[model samples]
Target: MNILVAHNYYQQIGGEEQVFLAECNLLESYGHSVYRYILNNDQIETTPPLELLGKTIWNWDVYQEMRSLIRQQNIQIVHFHNTFPLISPSAYYAAKAEGASVVQTFHNYRLLCPNALFLRDGKVCEDCLGKVIPWQGIQHNCYRGSKSASAAVVTMLTTHRLLQTWNRQVNAYIALTDFARDKFIQGGLPVGKVFVKPNFVDPDPGIGEGKGGYALFVGRLSVEKGIDVLLEAWAQLSTKIPLKIVGDGSLASEVNRATQQLRGIEWLGRRPMDEVYKLMQNAQFLIFPSKWYEGLPRTLIESFACGTPVIAANLGAMSSFVTPYETGLHFQLGKADDLVTQVEWAIAHPEQILQMRQNARTEFEIKYTSSESYQQLIKIYEKACIQ
Candidate 1:
């Protein structure tokens, strides 16, 4: 199959960027010819605000380029990762115009929320859900705290909704989880067009022995991630279990401060993937305390690949992934006391943790391996072509 993958890269590299690269590599590894059309957020630095807003609605250059690429390559499927504020929905029309099926991966809830996170004021806010125009987002200045910027995104969404671009142009929408698929459906995506496919970890990290006594937390240190809840939970613990945090974000200073005041807390800021994986392999269990509706975090899958049981918040998609006392355990979202209790339980039941470790590895093998993901991708592509 000839595939043209399009993505708009963020200025700061993130899970979506990694997933985009991994999918491209996954396709090429299976002998599929893959071509890429990429736009970076760095371009926003130089682009005038009005021009950026104009391009967000429809970029003629991107449309012309995509048309040419599809025709020249005879692309069977044009898979899109992210197309906000740069590549635009125009690319989807361009692909369909050239007789290529369009498959868009819903990495985040951009179609439903201007911020794409459904997060506002440190909590999950779905004020725009099911609304044809996200007027609430514009009123709240949801995108980058700029009302004008939010208005631009709202305009794009409203324009596309009116044009039936989302409904008609895109053949398939790949959602990362069943929870996300449901949300997209509630937000007005066609039920038949939406499909659930979780992200996979390539070149499997292999199972870990669970030898390390300490627990691990691997993600950004931000409010929505429940970092504050994690800190409070650590403070409440009767038995101080060694905890290593691996990531950097807005709350770096707060995390750094916690390391000094809290016993058995180590802050390893922004390590490379190799180093992070090493930590995952050695840790007794991984902690995911996110408080929002995450689009199936890659970190959780990575932990499973390492055969590490997770102690995650019982909220959103995390609740679906972590089976209680099976693959891992779940704590009450944003409740430090519940988290502490779960931590103590995990500490007391070493044998159960061992069993969970094996189960986590088995889960990874069954659901998250690159081979399984590739097969799923092929089916989605086939579905798009048939549609």
Candidate 2:
């Protein structure tokens, strides 16, 4: 199959960017001809605000280029990763115009909420979900903390919705988890068109020895990530279990401050992929304390691939993967006490933890391996092609 994979790269490289590249490589590895149409957020710096706003609604350049690419490449499927602010929904129309099946991955909730995170003021807020025009987001200046910017995104979402672009142009939507799939349905995506396909670790990092004594936390250090809750939980622990945090974000100073006062917590900031995988391979378990709905975090999958169980917040997609007394365990979201209790229990029961480690690795083999993901993706592509 000839596939044209499109994505608009964010300034800060993140999970979405990693998944986009990984999926492209996954397809090419299976002998599919893959072409890329990628744009970067750096272009926003030079672009006029008004022009950028207009482009967010519809980019004629992207449309023309995509249509040409589709026709020239004889692209069977056009899988889109991210198209906000620049590429827009115009690419979907271009693919349809050129008679190509459109498959969009719902990496985040951009269609339902202007900010795409459904997060506001350090908590989950769904004020814009199911709304035709995300007026609440515009009022709150949700996108980049600018009402004008928020208005631009709202306009784009509203415009496309009114034009039936999302409903008609895109043939299939890839939801990263069943939880995310249901959320998108509630947010107004076509029910039958939405399919759940979790992200997988490629090249099979393989099972780890799990010899490292410390627990690991590898993600952005932000308020929504429950960083404060994690710190408080660590402070209350009777037995100070070593905790290694590896990531940088808005709450770096807080992490730095906690590391100074807290004996067991160590902040490693951001590390390369190779270093991160090595850390995961050796770690006893990974900690995920996110408070908001997530579209299946890649870190959790990576942990599973490394034969490491996760002590995650019982919320959203994380809950689906981290089963109690199974692959891993979960604590009440944002409850420091609950987190500490779970941590203490996990630390005390070494045999149970060892069993969970085996279960985690089994979960990866059965569900998250690259081969399994490839087969699932092919089925989704075939469904879109038939449509």
Candidate 3:
């Protein structure tokens, strides 16, 4: 099958891009023809605000380019990973006009919330969930803390809603979790169009021994990731309990300060993928302290593939990802005290943690392998095409 896969890259490299690359590679590895269209958020730096807003609502150039690609390549499927603020809803219309089936993977809740996180003031905010206009998101300056930026997003969503673009143009919408799919439906995506498909770990970083004594935290060091709660919990933990931190983001300075002040905390900053997988393999377990409703973070699934159990906060899509005492333990969302308790339990119950390692690997083998994800994706594409 010939497919045109498109994605909008964030200024910072993240999991969504990883998935975009992986899925393209996956298709090629199986002998499918793959074409790619990429736009980067770095472009936002130079684009004027009004022009950006106009382009975001409908990128005429992108629409023409998409139509040409579909017609020339005879593209059977146009699978979109991300199209916000750049590629825009116009691309979907282009696909439909060219008679190419549209398959959109919603890595976040942009269709439901202007911020795409359903988060505000460091907590889950659903004021705009089911609203057609989502004026609440604009009122709260939800997108990058700028009312103008928020309004831009609101205008795009509102314009699309009024045009019925989301309902008629796209044939399939892939949500990373059932929770997310439900939320999108609640927010007005067609019920039959939305499907649940979790992200997978590629290249199979075989199960680890879980021999590393220190706990591990790998992700952006931002407040939304519950970094402050992690620091507070670490402060209360025994100095002998070591923590290895990886990745860099908005809270890099605060993480640096924490490493300096705390005895057992070691800040390794950002490491390459091999190094990260090695770290995951060696670590006893991974800590996912995120506060928002995630779109199935790669870190959590990667940890499971490594046979490393997680002590993740019980919230969002992650709440359903980790099964307590089975694959990993869950702590109360945003609660330093509860997180501390879960860590203490893992420390005390080495036997159960070992069992969890087995369970975690089994979970990966059963549901998160690259082959399984490919089959699921092809099924989704076939369904959309038939529709």
lDDT of 2 at 280: 94
Candidate 1 lDDT tens digits, 294-384:
9978899999999999999998899899999998999987889999889899999999999999999999999998999999989999999
lDDT leaderboard ranking: 3, 1, 2
lDDT for 346 (candidate 2) = 88
Error of 2 at 86 (Å): 0.9
Whole-model lDDT, candidate 3?
Answer: 0.93
Backbone Cα, N, C clashes tallied per candidate: 0, 0, 0
Model 3 vs. true fold: TM? 0.99
Q: Tens digit of lDDT per residue, candidate 3, span 259-302?
A: 88988899999999899999999898899999999999999999
Error of 1 at 372 (Å): 0.8
Give the higher-TM-score candidate: 2 or 3.
3
Which 10-residue window in model 3 sums to the lowest lDDT? 235-244
Query: Candidate 3: which stretches are off by over 4 Å?
Result: none
